[model samples]
Target: MESERYIRQTILKDFGLKSQKKLTKARVLVIGVGGLGIPVLQYLNAMGVGTIGLIDNDVVSLNNLHRQVLFSEKDINKTKISVAIKKLKKQNSTSKLIGYKLYLSKKNALSIIEKYDLIVDASDNFPTRYLVNDACVILGKPFVYGALHSFEGYVSVFNHKDGPTYRCLFPNPPKSEEIPNCNEQGVLGVIPGIIGNIQALEVVKVIAGIGSPLSGELLIFNGLEQEYHKFKINSLSKNKKIEELKDTYELECSFDNSSISSDAFKELLNSSTEIQLVDVRTTEEYNDYHLKQATHLPLKSIYLNHNSLDFEKTIYFICQSGVRSLEALRFLKKEQPEATLISINGGLNEFRNYDAKH
Candidate 1:
């Protein structure tokens, strides 16, 4: 009875009983249960991929219902693992599903990842994507990568058979503000279905050993334009070492620099101070709440107009929090290594609070 469920997929000459058998025995891990992850989980379970491991630490939210199909309005504030697991179980009782209700971090990444034969990196952030890629590289397991932004999404297979890795494709994380979060830039629900299904297809092809698995190529889809493109990724030739996982948010990941305290930042903000202030926050953010003395150069346009700043002078940087400011500092340092660029310790939020105290 269990074998009959997968007969339709097994009916293909190339993907016969043998491939079905392989899928039944394969252990796979999917790292997210969000928009991209929902479709991957659905189709993979439908395909009867045995021993599916789901690792996500988020609870269902009102915002998630817009694109994440696994949870409903009633499930809001409930754990995604609980909601998704129950739904998947009802959909395919034959496939084993284990859900971890915790997020992936450097501490648990390697241990949790090593247990799986393959990984699907449907993770939302650049840090986790790098974390998963490094873990898979170390574990010698191929993982499918999926990312969504606005009406665009892309899928690729990384760390397959010592092939090009995520770093091979994107050697550096984009400047934090340059890549907007889903909350900032909206994505159509159908986009993830397209990319996640392709990710699922790659998983099937790799496990079944049936067709080309997109090992060294990237697939990009634009929902607005209804266009698709595939490009070759040749990171294998570069042979950049992925011997071990470095700090995902460190200089190795392409953004690392220094920070200054709020007290010092306020002194610099004082009229007597002679430091140039650079605000990496958006024009809207600047309009809302900003230091009058600070110059507006959002992180997205920093690379283009960074040279306009007088590198010889001491420049202080600030953002909503210190994170983006540090990222901007790193970018500035890379282009102008000699520039004395330091981010405000607590960003504008802290700097503003300092004013209330005074």
Candidate 2:
């Protein structure tokens, strides 16, 4: 038998053959292969969890190498799930690794997650978090939740034996503008590793039933201070039950016209050309390289300066990859629906790519 591979852990009084058998039969689905997901994948695989499913559609970038330990410069531009699989496979072949190039969507989430016994919320966005929580609640499956921003990271177990759900912590999704995500705020490379390891540890504990899980508690780690704090999340039964999955996720529900391709946006730029461009990226990003005549209005200050936006020209909002731009678009559309609106597809990434080719 492969018991030799787990001999060290099996020798522990609490985590012996019974726990190892539970781990060998357990099925875990990790939601993202980004910063948090990669580390989570490595540990889960090393622990010999049976049937680990990796779902991610994003590509590996040069910038991701610092924190996404499974990826390297050679893996740049490759699909993150694919790159992560190669590394996880090499780590341990005993664990059955399944790779899905698809992203988590409301339509398929229930079906995709139904097969797994546990869910790992390694996602970077809020809508996906809600989706996972709802799915877990609906299926009576527990989930390990991890999140990071700057030097801060959070880990929590939601819907574990009816303990507490994510909504118990935050009743509703914050207004898109109020939450500027890790992309806009930026994160130190090592923050996710710390939180992800916690998530991985929680997964092992929950699956093997070995220790006291953070069922109703949230663990916050400050890398700068190297301090850890645990806080209780009260059960909010008002919104706990989910009868049916919503057709739309709130992240994209507000902004239908989020972004367009660089080529199409370029055509809009040169022809008919009454575009009023606003870069929603930070000032530092704008100073680095930006469209020659575009105004540098960061997402944080957009609300304060929105009144000054030109109503006459067709507005084209730009950001790193149009995420912030779409957030801004939602705000602007609600504020100034009378104005013509458009978003640079792919944002500055497209702009740089076009410039490089031309």
TM for every model, in the order presented, reads 0.73, 0.71
Tens digits of per-residue lDDT, candidate 2, 252-338, equal 323343445566567555654456788888878888788865787899999777776887766778888878887898888888888
Instruction: Work out candidate 2's RMSD over C-alphas.
Output: 10.4
Write candidate 1's Cα lDDT for 1-358 as tens digits: 8767878877889999999999999999999999989999999999989999999998999988878887899999999999999999999988999998898876688999889999999989877887888788877889999998888888888878856988788876765556787878887777888888889999999999978888889888898899999999886544345677653342222223355667545644553446688889888888787776778899999977777788898787889888898889888888888877877777888866554311
Give the runs in model 1 whose Cα sits over 4 Å from its true position: 237-240, 248-344, 347-358
Number of backbone-clashing residue pairs for each candidate, in the order shown: 0, 1
Clashing pairs for model 1 are: none
Please give the TM-score that candidate 2 achieves against the real structure.
0.71
